[model samples]
Each structure stands twice: as C-alpha cells, then as structure tokens.
Target chain A: MEFVQNFPFICIILSMFSAIVSFILPGKAAKYLHIGMVTAVLVLSAGTLAYVAGTGESYTFMMGQFPAPWGNEIRVGVLEALMAVIFCIIMLLSVFGGIAHVEREIQRSRKNLFYILLDLLLASLLALIYTNDLFTAYVFIEINTIAACGLIIVKKEARTYVSAIRYMVMSLVGSGLFLIGLSLLYGITGHLLMTPAKEALEKIIAQGTYHVPLVVIMVLVVIGLGIKSGMYLFHTWIPDTYGYTTPTCSAILSSLVSKSYIFLMIKIFFRVVGFDSIISSHLVNIIFVLGLIGMIMGSVAAIKENDIRRMTAFSSVAQIGYIYMGIGLGTTAGVVAALFHIIVHGITKSQLFISIAGLSDVSDGKQDFHSLKGAGFRCKIAGAAYTAASLSMVGMPFFSGFVSKYLFASSAMTAGSGRLIAAWIVLGVSTILNTVYFMRTVITIYTPVDEEMRKVHGISPSKTEQAAMAAMILLNVVVGVASTPIIRALESGLAMFG
Target chain B: MDVIINMLRNHYQDIAAVFLFVIGMTNLLLQQNLIKKIIGLDIMDSAIYLFLASKGYIAGRTAPIVVDGITDVERYINPIPAGLVLTGIVVSVSVSALMMALTICLYREYHTLNLDEIMMKIRKEED
Candidate 1:
C-alpha cells in the first residue's frame, strides 16, 4: 500500500490527538497548537488531493483486518480530498480571524476548552467526510454536535447558554432520526458498510419488497440531515445559535459544520441508497418543492431581520435551500452544481462572517445596521473584504457566487419542463432577494455617520485579521475567475464518488 | 381491521418502537420545560435502541458468545445491532449529560426550568 493512503487516517487521529492534547495545555500554548495542527492537516490534505486528482481513483483504507463487508473503512477520493483541503484552509482562516475575539470574550479558564472543542469539531467533520461505515458516521455526528455545543457555551453568557441548549435539542433530534434510519437500513440490508449496503439495497429494490420501509428510511435519513444542515423550517435554532455565539463559532457553524451534513447526504445518495433510488422514490420532488419554499421564505426572513448576524444566518437557510434544490433536480449536472455551490457558499459565507466580525469591532462591537453605519470607512480592510464577499453573495459577475448560480441555472435547463421552470423562477427571485439584503448591508456599512458619531475613533484591525481577510478575498476571487479547473475537478471527482 | 391486526401481530416490536418514537418526538417538540425536553430526547434515543435490539434478536437463538465453542452462524442472533445499540446508548448518555449540564447553566442564570420563562427573562434583560 502507498504511504499516502495513511494520510486520511493520520489526519483524523492527529486532529483527535490535538483535541486531547490541547485539553491539558495552557490557553496560549493551545492556540499555537491548533495553528500547527491545522497547518499540518492542510498540507497533508493538499498532498492527498493532488495525488487523488492525478490518479483519478478512489482508495479505501481499511481500519482493521476485516475487508469490504466488515470492520471499518474510510474511502478517500478526489472529491473528499478536495473538500478536506478546503475545509482545513477555511478552518485555519476562521481561527486566525476569530482568535482575538476568543481571547477577549471568553473567560481565561475556559479559553483552552474552546480550542479543544474546535479540534474535536474538526476531527468529527473529517470523520464524517471519510467514514464508509454508517455507524461510525453516527458516532462522529454525535461528537460534532457535542463539540459544537461546547463552542457556543464556552462564551459563558446567558444568551449563549440558551442558544446552546436549543442547538443541542435540535441536533439530538436530528441524530436520533438518523440513527433510526440507519438501523432500519441495517435491518433491510444487514450490512453497515456503504458498498455492501448499496449492493443489498439494490437487490432489495429489484426484489420489490419492503418498499414502504425503504421510502421511510429515505425520508428519515434525508430529513434528519436536512434538519442538521438547517434546512428551511428546521432552521429555528439557526439565528440565535449563529448570532449569539462568538464570531469564529458562527463562521465555522454556518460554513463547515452545516456543510458536512449536506456532504454526507450527497455521499449517501451516491454510495448507499443510490441516486437512482432517490429520484425514483419521488423524494426529490418533495425536496424540490421545499427547496423552492425555503429559498423564498428564508430570504424574506433575512430581509426582516435587523441584526446583521441574524441576517447572515437567515441567508444560510436560503443557500442551503439552493443546494437541496439542485439535489432535487436529480441530474449529474445538478449535483455538480450543488457541490460547486457548497464550495462557493462555504468560502463566501465564512469570509462574510469573519469580515463582519471585523466591521462590528470597529463599530462599538455592535451588529445592528444602525451602529454598523459608516463602519466600512472606519475599517478599510474589513470594508473592502466585506464588500467583496457581499458582491459574491449578491451573485455579481466575476465572483464565485455568480459562478455557482450560473451552474445552477444551466443545470436546471436539463431538467423536465416543470422543474426547469420552477428552478429558474426561484433562482431568479432568490438572486434578486440576495442582492437586496446583501447589497443593503454593503451600502449601510459604507453610509456616512453624523459628525459626533464619526468622532468615535475606530481601531484598525490587527495584522493577523487583515491578513485573514485578504486571504479570504483572494480565495473568493480565485474561485470566481479560475473556476474552470475547480469545476472540472468537481465533475471528475463526483464521477469517482461511488 | 384484519390488515391492522396482522401488522400488529407480526411487527409488534417495530410498531411499539415507532409509537414511542412519535411520542418522544412530540414531547421534544411541544414541551416548554427544559428537563422535559431532555427526557423527551432520551425517550427518542431509547426507542431507537429498542428498535435496534428487536432487529438483532432472533427467536430460539442463543447469545453470540459461542456456547460450547459452537461456531455455527445459525446458533446466534445478529450481533451488529447489539453493537449498534451499545454505541447508541453511549452517545445518548453523553448527550443527555451535556443537556443536563446546559440545563444547570440555564437554571443558574434564570432560576427556572421552563424554556418559555427563560426566553421571556432573556427578552426582559435584553430590553
């Protein structure tokens, strides 16, 4: 076996090890430890991405002596490696951008605990990405939930406490449903491994037995993950959880944490139950209609929100709706578009959160539009970065968001007339709504304040924050302009998905 | 009635598990009290474990401990669901403990176990 095959397991173990090691270390040391760990994972995943993309083959690394149908295994392919690399990059940037807030907002005694949770969260996300076993994925989903809750509660405020519990309650419900679905799947297929489960499911489908149970399992798993990913109506916990938490936590939660569940759902479609079944089951139609509703309703809610953080949180609901909408199309082009939107939204949304954090810092630590007025001019770097991110979100040409929307539009063209028309209308209306709120935010931040308010001196962002913002903007533009290769990579990577 | 009776007779365990799941889900969604919500979550998790246990159990089969060194597959029920149930229990325990810890935090701040009351207090404080 090649040495690079070990990279996936090594990355998971290393992050877990860091979580444990950081628990014992002092806060300052743990911060540096996290940086070192992220950098290491970033490098390893980059190497793995290059190798996998070059070979164009997916490899399964056995976790024990048992082979395909038994024991544990993690499959790494071009898509998974690409996701890992980008996830690590975004994580490192989020930490870099939000560490100052962490130091300031959290009590000294609990600071290390924050990093511990971050490490565990990263480990769980990596495990979710790589694990081929349904049960292993469930375990990591629990770990992800717990670690994310700790991230919220680490700030030690009444609001954070309330929001954390709400988040926990919702997460537990989601995971519980997911577990029941997996157990039922096991009962039908008698296999926990994805490949074996797929084989069994195919046989069962051919035999045409247990049709009701199969559909029930599909709905359970999809809805479970949908709730976790903050799909539309299941997004009641989103705004408070994202708005009240520390900025870094919100950035990670909105971008990577919710995204992993969606990625896992996509994996299940391709690997376990099969996308053909997903389409044939008529579940995609329901997903399609819900996605359409969420796209309109989420944006409407965001428009109603006065607080900037809550606005972004609501925007996430709309973006998640777009991804599900693409999946609902149930075409290869549509799935690819959805995957591209994942990358685009992940990079663009994190950038928005991190930059907005900087913006609010210069505006008396306020997140409302009234206080954030003129914040852009005061904090030039944050302003530029925020503007760039907002432009991307608004789907302007020459931005990553535009590329994704374009992909979605073209993908919709290939669908049936009814779906194509619905997707187009929603896409058009959603884009308009996205422009309305995001551009309003941009304009508000750049709006001039009164002389007295202008006299309040704004502190320039620290060197690290400036750099993080620059890196994010650079990534956003690079993804937008040089998107051909990335899209091609996603297409080919998806080909090897199963 | 005949179809319902057949379903109840043949799939009693699954029906009961589904009933408990629905009840737990209802409580978790509708309950105003924090502790009751946690209890609801536990009930939901327990329902899943029971479902899994039922899936693993086979009538007239011994445990998978290999009694008298019997290696025959038919001598034991499927052990995968047992393992899955164990894992589910551990996850639920930790999650319930975390929920309880958060409940304590909420109680410390608001002096109430009702989520609605707490939300009202939070609104008052914010205003």
Candidate 2:
C-alpha cells in the first residue's frame, strides 16, 4: 500500500532515469528501451490510481523530506489521479501511433534523442500534475516548454526551427509574467503555499477596494497562462508550430502540453486566485469574450486551410476555446464540463492525429482531401476509427464531444451569462462548420475510386496500427457512455473549491 | 518637483528595472536579426532578475547568512529571490542554447540567416 502511495512520484523519477539511460544507450536498443520505460510508468500510474480509489485517501509526499512552505510536496488526490490516468492513457496511445511514423521519419542517429526528450516531457507533465506548490509548478512548466521545443524541432527543419523559436519566446514571456504574479502573491502572503496564498488574497480582498498590485498580478498571471494555453490573442504561434511539426509531435503538443497548461490555469484561478474576486470583478466576462473569439475565429480559419495538419491545428484552437468558455462561466457545472472536454478532446484529437498518420503513409505525404480519396476502403479499421473520432469531435449524440458540449451549454445558461448564451450560438455555428470541413475529409476517404487507381495504391495499415486505432475508438465510445460517473467523481473532487 | 524626485529616489530599484525592461522590449521589437533578438530577450530577462532582487532588498541590510551566536543579527535582504534568479539564469541559458541550435538548423535549411529572405522563400513555397 505504501509503495502504491508513492507510485506516481516514483514513476516520474523512473521516467527521468529512463530518459538518461535512453540517451546513453546505443541507437538500435533505445527505442525498445524507451517503450519499456513508458509501459512501466503507465503501470505505475494505474497502480497509483487504483490505490487512491481503494484507499480514498490523498497521498502526500514532501520531496527531500522537507516540510511545507519550503520544499515541494506531491499530492495524489482524486483530481491528480484522474489527470494521471488520462495522461498515461493518451501517452500509451501516442506511443502506439508514434512508433511507425517515428521510425519512418526520424533519422536513425537522432531516434534515441527523440525518445529521451519524449520521456522527459512525460515526466515533467506527471510532476506538474502531482505538485502542490506553485513554484514547483512553475519549474515544471519551464521544463515542459523546453522539452516540447526540443521535440518539435527534432527533425531540424527550417520551418520547425522557426516555429520552435517563436514558441520559445512566447513561453519565456509567459513564464516571466507568471513569476511576477507569484512575487506579488509572495509579497503579501509571506508564503508560497496555495492555501496560504488564497487566505492572503481573501484578507486583501476584505479591505473593500482591490489592491492595484494584486490586480496587476492577476492580469500578469492571466496573460502568462493565456500564452501557454494558446488562447486567441496569444495563439499566433500555434498553427505555424503544429503545422510544421510531425504528426506524432503535433499529437503530443496538442493532446498533452496544451491541456497541462490549462490544468495549471484552473489550479491557479480556482485555488490560488480565489473565484470570488474573479466573478465579482467580471473578469470571467473577459475570459468569455476571448474564448468566444477563439471559437469563432479558429473554426473560420480552419475551414480555409487545405493542409490536413494545419486544419487539425486550427481545429485544436477552437476546441481549446470550448474548454475555456466552459471554465470562464465560473459555475461548478461549467468547470466540470471544461475538465471533461479537456480529457475527451485529448483522447479524440490524439486518435485523430494517429489515424492521420496512417493516411499520410498511405498517401505518400499528399495529405490534401483530394489525395485521400477512397482511403476508407484501403484501411477500413483506421478509416472507421477516424470517422468515429471525428464524429465525437463534431459532437454527435452518444459521442464524447456531445456530452461535454451539452454540459457546457447548460452550465452557461444556468449561470445566466447572456454573452455566454451568444457564445453558445457561436459554438453551435462553429460546430456545423467543423462538421462541414471534417466530413469533407471523411467523405473523401470513403468515396469511390477508379478501379485502375485501386490496383496501384491499396495501402492498408499494419496490425499494430489497427489495434491502436481500435483501442482509441473503444475509449472514445466508453468515455461517451460512461461520462456521468466521471463527471460525478470530478464534482466530488472539486467540492473542496466550493 | 521635490515630491517627484523623492518618489524617484524611493523607488530607484524598481525604476531601473522598468527602464531596463523597456529598453529590452524596444530592442526586441526593433531588431531585425535573430541573434540580436535573442540578445534582447536576455536583456529582458536580466531586467526581471533585477526587479526581483530589488524587491528582496532592505535598507542597510547585508546578504543573508547565519553565523554562530548571531542572536541579534539585523534584517538582511531576502535571499529567496536571489536563489530563484540562479535557477532562472540556468533556464534562460538552456533556452538560449536551444534557440542557437534552432537558428543553426534554420541557416542550414534555408542557406541564409536573414529572416526576411527565409520568410520570403517560405511564402514562395506556399504559393
């Protein structure tokens, strides 16, 4: 039991160790070793979740055996466990989807380095979700950014390098703003703990007039996290970066990296900043406006993109806005809906990306809609999986997106945000736009082809690819059907905020 | 005038930090070359370090250190931000190295270091 209690942290350390070992090992041995390490980490994370669920106690461990307010403490509560489970599942699927694509695209010499950076990225994400201290979160965010940048440019292409550099600049600015915010909180509280920070903020708020420094700090934190979250105004780097990266790299960045930042933003907004001031001051409206813009603009831009990856990249922007709009409502149901969307979108988008990988392979990099004609019959399972995932993305009934979007719209109405109501209309229109574009691609895949064309290029996915797609599709269906239980669990976990 | 001067003197450290930050921002915005932009980023980062260190300072205080039998030791400037800046410096260095590697890759790919020319080529390719 004790071993299971320590499992999440242990998995993080093990991942880091494996990353080191991956760097040191010979090239041919490294890929297998990396997969072994990730599988082990996945098992550890599962054990941790089972232990948490069985014991119903939060697991707490102070790093370096130091006490609170000084050294970091990793807490594996229900929320952390839930996020861990999601992260591990997505990571496992990514590995499955990544193997063939990585093997084909990455140079032989740099393959080991790719695995090392990938493991380090996963390790940093796990650490970010587990830590309770805000400063520790900051450190993990920095590590995550660096590791993500490395992974993005692993192929050393000029476009990839430029996009990575742009991402780097944006991340550093965001981190700087976040640090300034933290400093302000520390100046008032004399402690860096989340609970203490909240208490201190309450005391400051009780003085009637809000402190200018605190407001400045809040704005700084929002802008900083906004960049990391790739919210509308700060999202210039996203399409270019995701467009230029490989499918596997794009999946990792989109599915995990963006969500981790959103998670941190939730932690900061609810736990550290205190929701009372945020709602009372009408900053939630500002968030809603930005999110609405993102939702509308992203979908419109995506409809115009011809490149498969770029279109998907823009779609991610719209999806992120949906999550943010839910959170921006400031209702309990809204928060839960947002968290649900984060998880569901993570899995569905990753599956979609992986399936696109198969499409890319079959089409010989001709990833346009026209080039993918009749691909459904060629690789039936992947095509079916892709269709199912895309249906979920478009919020078809009995699919994952439908549940989250329903929850979000209901919550917005309950919260009485007329702006959010209008935002919901925008979201609905965008959902239709989303369907128009994605369905175009889907239909292109299944459309009848000339008999002569079929003889020349009848590429089907391998068994592993088929299995991976099936697993992802199964997850999408199961999560859709069983969303209520997960929502209830999330509600219980978030009850502490109320 | 006297009040303004007093205010300036009172917040001298903060004023200096903000000044340096503005300079860095201007350089970053105006600079055309990639390496120069990196230099501007460093300048901006150093400004933040200065701001943090200044926030930690107290008048007539020495560096934070403990000695035996120092029961009546006067207040010292906060050491936490200094420690944080050390870590921040390391982070910035790593970012700089990555940026340099990216620039090297960009040069290799485009056979040019000028951002405008490279962007033009990319636009041409897109069209």
Candidate 3:
C-alpha cells in the first residue's frame, strides 16, 4: 500500500492524541498545539487529496487485523480527502481570526479546555468523514456532540449555558433516534460495516423482505441527522446556540460541525441504504418539500431578525436548506451540487462569522443593526471581507456561492417536472431573499455615521486575523472562478463512493 | 384488535421499547423541570438499550462465551447488540452527567430548576 493511504488514519489519531495531550498543557501551549495539529492535518489531507484524485480510486484501511464485517475501517477517497483539507483550513483560519475573542470571551482558567474540545471536535469530524463502520460513526457522533457542547459552555454566561443545554438536549434526542435506527438496521442486516450492510440490504430488497421496517429505519436516520444539521422546523435551537457563542465557536459550529452530520447522512444514503432503494422509498419527496419550506422560511426568519448575529445564524438554516434540497434531488448531479455547496457555504459563512468579531470590536462590542452602522468604515479589513462574503452568499458572479447556485439550478433542470418546478421556484425565491437580507446588512454596515458615532474610531484587526480573513476570502473567489476542476473532482470522487 | 393482539403477542419486546421511547421523548420535551428532562433523556436511552438487548437475546441459546469448547454459532446469542448496548450505556451516562452539570450551573445562576423560568429570566435580563 502507498504511504499516503495511512494519512487518513494518522490524521484522526493525531487529532485525538492532541486533544488528550492538550488537557495537560497550559493554555498557550494548548493553543500552539491546536495550530500545529490543524496545520499538520491540513498538509496531510492535501497530500492525500492529490494522491487520491490522481489515482481515482478509494481505499479502506482496517482498524484491526480483521477485515470487512469484523473490523472497523476508515475509507479515504478524493471527496473525503478534499473535505478534510477544507475542514482543516477553515478550522485553522477560524482559530486565527477569532483568537482575540477567545481571549476576551473565555475565562483564563478554561482556555486550555477550549482547545481540548476543539481538538476533540476535529478528531470526531475526521472520524465521521472517514469511518466505514456505522457503529464507529455513532460513537464519534456522540463525541462530536459532547465536544461541541463544551465549546459553547466555555464562554461562562447564562445565555451560553442555556443555549448549550438546549443544544445538548436536541442533539441527544437526535442521536437517540439515530441509535435506535442503527439498532434496527443491524438487527435486520446483521452487519455494522457499511459495505456489508449495503450488500445485506441489497439482498433484502431483491427478496422483498422487511420493507416496512426499512422505511421506518430510513425515516429515523434522516430525521435524526436532519434535526442535528438544523433542517427546517427542527432548527429552533440554532439562533440561540449559534448566536450566543464566541465567534470561533459560532463559525466552526455553523460551518464544519453541522456539515459533518450532513456529510455522514449522505454517506449513509449512498453506502448503506443504496441510492436505488432510497429513491424507490420515496423519502426524497418528503425531504424535498421540507427543504423547500426551509429555504423560504429560514430567509424570512433572517429578514425579521433584529440582531445581526442572529440574522446570520438564521441564514445558516437557509444554507443548510439548500444543501438538503440538492440531496432531495436524488441524482448524482444533485449530490455533487450539494457537496459543492457544502464547501462554498463553509468558506463563505466562516468568513462572515469571523469578520463579525472585527466589525463588532469597532462598534463598541455591539452586534445590533443600529449599533453596527458604519462598522465597515471603522474596520476596513473586516468590512471588506464581510462585503466579499455577503456578495458570495448573494450569488454574485465570480463568487463561490454563484457557482454552487448555478450547479443546483443545472442539477434541478434534469429532475422530473414537479420537482424541477419546485426546486427552481424555491431556488429563485431563496436567492432573492438571500439578496434582500445580505445586501441590506452590507448597506447597514457601510452606511456613513454622524460625527457623534465617529468617536468609536477604527479598531484594526490583528495581523493574524487580517491574514486569515484574506485567505478565506481568496479561497471563496478561487473556488468560484476555478470551480470546473473542483466539480470534476467531486463527480469522480462521488463515483467511487460505494 | 386481533391484529394488534397478534403484534403484541409476537413482538412484545419491540412494542414495549417503542412505548417507552415515546413516553420518555414526551417527558423530555414536555417537562419543565431540568432534572425531569435529564431523567427523560435517561429513560429514552434505557428504552434503546432495552430494545438492543432484546434484539440480541435468543430463547434457547446460552451466553456468547463457549463452554466445553462448543464453538457452534447457533449455540450462542448474537453478541453485537450486547456490545452496542454497553457502548450506548456509557455514552448515555456521560451525556446525563453533562446535562446534570449544566443544570447545576443554571440553578447556581438563577436559583431555579425550571427551564421555562430560566429562559424567561434570561430574556428579561437581555432586555
């Protein structure tokens, strides 16, 4: 086997090791460990992405001496490797951009703990991305949930505590349903590894056995992950959970954490359940209608939100809705579109959240629309970055969001009549709504202030933050302008999904 | 009624598990007190464990371990669900503990155990 094949397991193990080691280190040491670990993971994943894309083959490494049904495994492909690279880059940039807020918002005694949770979060996300065993994925999902809760509660405020609890309660419910679903699936298929489970399911489908139970299991898993990823009506906890946290926490949770759950769902759909069975089950129709509602309703909520941070949080619900709508299309083109949107939204949203820290710094730590007036002029770097992010999110030409939106539209054109119409109508209306709120926020921040408000003055972001913001925005534009290769890579990568 | 009776007769374990799950979920969602909510979560977890355990059990099979070198597959019950149940139990304990710790923090700040009351107080303070 090539040495690059070991990179996937090493990335997961190294992150987990760092998480454990960070608990014993000082706060500054932990921070350094975090940066070093994320950078190392990024390099490793980039190398793996290059190799996997070049070879055009996916490989699975056994966790123990046993293989197949008996052993846990990690599967690495171009898609998984590319996702790992993007996750690491976004995590590193988020940390660098929001370290100031981390210092200010988190208590001194708990800073190391914060890094520990971040390391664990990274580990669990990597595990979720690569794991070939359904049971292993479940264990890591719980770990991810716990680490995310710790990240939120480290802020030490009543609001954070409340939101953290709410987040935990909802997540626990989701995981419970997921666990039960897995249990039923295991009972029926008698395999926990995804490939074996897929084989077993295919046989069952051929024999026309246990059809009712299969449908129930599908609903359980979908609803479980949907709630966790902030799908539609189940997203009530998002604003509180995403709004009250520190900027880094908010960015990571919005961009990486939720996306990991959605990615895992997509994996289960293609690998374990089999796309044919999923389509024949007609659950995609339900997901389609719900995602359509979510697309419009989420943007409406964002428009009504008075608080700037909460508005951005609401926008995430809409973004997540778009990804699900792609999944609901139930075609390979649709899944590729969903995967592309995942990357674009991850990049654009992190930039938006991290820039908020800088913008609010100049606005006397206020995040309301009125107090944020002229924040763009005060913090020029943040203002420019936020404007770029908003433009991308609004699907302007030469921005990453435009590419994903274009992909979704083209993918929708291939669907059946009813769905094609629904997808286009929702997509068009959602884009207009996206424009309304995002452009309005941009105008609000850049609006000139009177002399009385000018006293707040420019509070330039630190060099590290400025550089991170620049890297993120550059990535956004690059992914936009040079999207053909990425989309081709995704198409080829998804071909190897099973 | 006969169909319901037939389901209850054969799949009693699954029926009970689903019942317990619904009851626990309702409690978790409807209960106002933080402790009760945590209890609800625990009950829900227990329902899953029970379901898993029942799935693994067989009427005539012995324990998974071989006695007297009887290595036949049919001699033992399925062991995967047992392992999964154990993992689920450990996870639930940790989650319940985390929830309890959060409850303690909430009580420390507000001197109340009611989630609705706490949220109301927070909104009041925010304004």
Candidate 4:
C-alpha cells in the first residue's frame, strides 16, 4: 500500500528501464516486452489514481533525500495526480494504437528504436508534469523534444526530416528566450524557488520602480512559451510537423506535447506572475487577442485543407486557441475551463488521429476525402467512432467538448471582456465550419463505391487493431458521459486559485 | 569623442555584448547557409553570456578568495551566471550537433545545401 503511494515515480523508472531492455531484446521479443511494460504502467497508474482518490490528500516526495529550497520536490497534489491519471489513460490508448499501427505501417527493423523513444517520450512528459523545480522542468522539456524529433525521423521521409528540423529550430529559439526570462527572474529575486521568486516580483512591482528590462524579459518569456504551445503567429511549425508524422506519433505530439507547454504557461502566468498583476498590465488582453486570431485563422485554414491529416493538424491549432482564450479571460471559471479543455481536447484529438490511422489501414494508404468514399460501410466500428468524435468536436451536447466550450464562453461573459465574447462568437462560427468540413469527409466515407473499386480497396484490420480501436472508442464514450465527476474533482484541485 | 570613449570604457563589457549581438543577428539574417546561421545563433548566445558576466563585474576588485591566514578578500564576479552559461553552452553544442546531422540528412535527400533549392524540390514533389 505504501509502495502504491510512490507509484508515479516508480512508473517513470519502470518506463525508462523497459526502454533500456527493449534496446537489447530482439524484434519479436521487444514488441511483446514493450506491450507488457505499457500494460504494467496502465495498471500501476489505475491503482495510484484509486489510492489518491481514496486518501483525498496530497503527497510530496523529495528526490535524492533532500529538503525543499535546495532539492528537487515532486508534488502529487490533487491537480498533479489528476493530470497524471489523464496522462496514463491517454498513454495507454496511444500504446495500443501505436502497437497496432507500428506492426503494419512501420518496418520491423526500426521497431526497437520506436518503442524505446516512445517510452522515453512518455517518461519525460511524466517527469515534466511531476517536477516542481523550474530548471529540472526545462531539462525534461528538452528531453521530450529530443525524443519527439527522433520519433519524427523514424519514418525517414524527406518531409518528416524537414518538419523535425523546423521544430528543433523553433524550440531552440523558444528555450533560449525562456532561459533569458529565467536569468532575469533570478537576477531580480536572487532565488530559483517559485514562491520566493513571485514574492520578490510582487515587491518590486509594488515599489513602483518599473524596470523596462524586466518588462522586456517577461514579454520574451511569453512569446517563447507562446511559440512552444503553438499559439498563433508563432504556430508556423505545427501543421507541417503534425501533418508529416505517423498518426500514432501525431496523436502523442498533439495530445501531450502542446498540453505540457500549456501547463507550464498556467504555472507561470497564474502562479508565478500572479493573474491579478498580469491582468492589471495589458498582457492578458494581448493573450486574448492572440487566442482570438488563432481560433479564427486555424479554423478557416482547416476548412480549406484537402489533406485529412493537415486538416486535423489545423484543428489542433484552433483547439489550442480555445485553451489560450480560457486562460486569457483571467477568471476562476476561465482557468477551470482551460484546464478542463486540455483534458477533453487531448482525448478527442488523440482518438481522431487513431481513427485516421485505422482508416489508413483499411483503405490502403488512401487518406484523402475522395479516396475515402464508402469506407464507413466497410469499417463500421471505426467509422462510428470517428463520427461520434467528430460530433464532439462540433460541441454536441452529451460530449466532453460541449461542457468545455460552454464553461469557456460563460467564463468570458463573467469576465466582462466584450471583445472576448465577440471572439467566442466567432469561434462558435468556426466550430460550425469545423463540423461542415468533418461531416463532408464523413459523408464521403459512407458514399457508395463501384464494384471494381470495392474489390480493389477491400481491406480490414486484424483482431488486435479492432480491439485497440474499441478501447479508444469506449474511453471517449465513458469520458463524455462521466465528465461531471471529473469536473468536480478538478474544481477541488483548482481551489488554490480561489 | 573623449566623453564617449570614457563612457564606453566604463561599460566595456556592455559595448562588447552589443557588438557580439549585432554580429550574431546579422549573420543569422544574412547568411544563406545553414551552418553559418547556427554559428550566428552561438554568437548571439555568447552575447547574453557577456551581458550576464558584465553585470557581476566591479572595478579594482580581485577574485574573491579565502585561504589560510588570508582575512581580506576582494570582490569577485558573480558565479551564478558562469554556472548558467556552462549549462547553456552544453545545450547549444548539443543543438548544433543535431542541426548538423539534420543538415546531412537534408543534403542526402535533396543533394544540395541551398535552402531555396531544397524547398523548391519539396514543393515540386507536393504539387
């Protein structure tokens, strides 16, 4: 029982251990070993969630047997635990999806490296979520970026290489800016501890000796993180990167990578900078405007895209906009909305990508709308899942997306940001536009094909693939129906802001 | 001119930092070659290091030291930014290595080091 309390860190260690073992194992053995490790992680995560929920208390473990203000502290508060739980659920689904897709799509020679980098990616994301130290967080972010780039290049496509390069360049610039911000912060405060840093910043601000250098540093930090999170105007790298990667990798990158950055943004803006102070300045308004532009531009671009993967990539850009919009509103509900949207959107987008992967399998590399004609009649389960998930993206009632959008809009109204409200209305129109494009694709999937074409395109997934698709579909359904309890849990976790 | 020189001497490190930054930005903007752009990034990064190092400088002060029977110790530069720069240097070197590998891959694929030519090839294939 006590061991279960330390399961989060244990899970991370186990992932890294499995990654090392996978390198030495043979191809067939490595695949099974990877599956076994992912399953163990899933069980461990479930048990940890149950234990945490039962105790209803936070726990902190300082790594290397050191105390705070000098040592690394891993806090498993309600928010951290909840996010961990979500991460585990998504990772589990991704594991199954990756297993099935990798077997068919990816070559056998690269299987070992694929599994190793995948596990490393998961471990780094977990580390990023759990660690309290800012410098340690930066290290984990770099690790995740490196592993993601490795995954991108596994396909060996020229476009994939180009996208990975762009991603790497942009990330370097972003991290450099983040370092500058951290340096300035340390200069002003003489400490790296977030609590002390915030106190020092507040004191400096209250003294009314506004320093231009400090302001410039803050702006640089915001822009840096904004680029990392794929916020508009700095989001040029996203569509190409996500569009070129394999569907399974795309799912992880879209669901996990951007959300991690958003989490950091929340930590910085709300906790470190203090939302009150940010709002007093014009930073909050700037974030709001950026979010609005992203929402409009991303949706419009998705509407015009012909490639299925590129369309989904653009959709992610728009979804990130919603998150920023929520945070930009600067109200309690808005914060809650942002957090909730991160979870819901993570599930929805991952499922969509997984479904696309399944569709590619059934359609034999035919991913465009025209070639997808009559796919629904062939792949019934995946078709139904895609339809439901797409409906959720359109903000249909009884789905997780609806609750998030409603909360976000209501929060903007309460915040008295009339411009934000107008932005939300425009976003609402964009959502409809999203529905129109997705429905067009869906209707084409159901449209009848000729006999010759049917015979040529007659392909179906194996039993394992069906099971994986079913698992993801069930998760989507369960999350949609059982969102209220999750929302309640999150509200309790976010009580600190109030 | 004498007054300006005196001011520059008083802030020699700042002037050096500004010069390095301008050089880096120029190289990054004007250089068509990828490796040169990366070198420019390093130059820009070094400028920041200079700035941080300069912030810790004080005139007429020796290195802060404590030894046996040595009670009077002069002020020394701040050690924090030096430590930070060490980490930053490691990060930059690793990034450059990755970029160099990526450049090799790009050359292998497109058979050219020219950015415009590589992009043209990609677009042609896409169309």
Candidate 1 vs candidate 4, lDDT winner: 1
| lDDT tens digits by residue: candidate 2, A115-166 | 8888889898998888777877888888899999988887767678878877
Report lDDT per candidate.
0.91, 0.80, 0.92, 0.76
Candidate 4 lDDT, A281-347, residue by residue in tens? 7787888888878888888888898888888889888889889888888677787889999998888
Q: Lowest summed-lDDT stretch of 10 residues in model 3 chain A?
A: A451-460
Tens-digit lDDT string for candidate 3 (A1-498): 889889989999999999899888999999999999999999999999999988889999987668788988899998899899999989999999998778877878889999999999999999999999998999999999999999888888888999998899889889989999999999999999999999999999999999999999999999999989899989998999989889999999999999999999999998999877888999998888888889999999999998889999999999999999999998899999999999999999999999988888888888999889988878888988999999999899999999999999999987788889899999999999999999999999989787777555545577888888898889899999999998998998889996
What is the per-residue lDDT of model 1 for residues A210-241, given as tens digits with 9 covering 90 to 100? 99999999999999999999988798999988
What is the C-alpha lDDT profile of model 2 across B12-115, one tens digit per residue? 88788778876775655456577886787788778888887777778787776766555445656667877877877888788778778777888788887667
Best by lDDT: 3
* DockQ per candidate: 0.88, 0.59, 0.82, 0.43
Question: After superposition, which runs of candidate 1 have C-alpha atoms over 4 Å from their true positions?
Answer: A450-459, B1-3
Q: Over the true interface residues, superposed, what is the Cα RMSD of model 2?
A: 1.8
**For candidate 4 chain A, which ten residues in a row score worst on lDDT?**
A452-461
- Give the Cα error of residue A338 in candidate 3, in Å: 0.7
Residue pairs with backbone atoms closer than 3 Å in model 1 (clashes)? none
* Model 2 clashes, total count: 0
Pick by TM-score: 1 or 4, better one: 1
Clashes found in each candidate (C-alpha, N, C closer than 3 A): 0, 0, 0, 0
